[model samples]
Target: MFAVIKTGGKQYKVAKDDVIVIEKLEGEAGEAVSFDSVLMVGEGAETKAGVPFVEGASVAAEVVEQTRGDKILIFKKKRRKNHRRTNGHRQDLTVVKITDILTDGKKAAAKAKKAAPKKEAADGDAEAAPKEAKAEKPKAAKKAPAKKAAAKKATAKKAPAKKAAAKKKED
Candidate 1:
């Protein structure tokens, strides 16, 4: 079975036990890397394509080695200007062996791993909030009654002042 995977802004056609050279991946040798973006998969005479990317399709590969790729010599020259420059570069790469092609893919694994810890954290917060609310309720109730008593006293004083002003006007 052969599959085409896209990684690092490039695409590679790969199969099990087939060695391929590609742009650098960040890792040491003998590490495992799984490519989640699978564009196409073919086996024997059958081929399946992805709409943008195949849903639930993945390729798991083992990083067999990591090394520098072929050196590219960049030369710039201008006639009659005595300007010539040359530079060489080598790109880092990781050699990986295709291990497995999962048609149902990596989304399930990633989603499960991503959600488990979040759910646990949310439950922990939920359990702690009720205790804090219980501790705060009595203090809130005491403040509410104090505010009501202050408002009643202010109204009582204003009513007597209005009555005194009315008697003065009549005299």
Candidate 2:
């Protein structure tokens, strides 16, 4: 089944499990959102449309993320007037995934919370190996920066001498 819904001053045809990016909506990730301004609903040849909105029809979605749209650059120029303007804009947006389409004034079901993946209790040694390897990486990374510091000190000494010569030339 599919439905035509109106939101953010626009219209969209959506179905179950469909993901769409729409105008900015209030809510964090994994939050439930509903659209009651359904313009039409259809299954195969049978379809229902409304005068303005379908009565007792709604669309249920889950907020995937709150994000911003792509940047849009606006440039304006008036010939021979020496007036010019350059501006850019990125619209706030939201990504949503459709979960259900309901009619007859039905309310959306509550969303389920995700849980962390379970690790094997029998493999306690597997966890310790990774922690030991991670400890060695930072020690090697720290030694490389000491060489860069010595090179930076040599350049710093030359910079001050060049500035002193420039000062003598001015005098």
**Against the true structure, whose lDDT is highest?**
2
Give the local distance difference test score of model 2: 0.90
Residue-by-residue lDDT tens digits, candidate 2, 1-171: 999999999999999999999999998788789999999999999999999999999999999998998899999999999999999999999999999999999999887643212234326568786887899999999999999999999888764444433434553
Residue pairs in collision within model 1: none
- When summed lDDT is taken over every stretch of 10 residues in candidate 2, the lowest stretch is 113-122
Per-residue lDDT of model 1, residues 54-121, tens digit only: 88888877667878988999999999999999999999888877777888654322213334576597
Alpha carbon lDDT of each predicted model: 0.80, 0.90
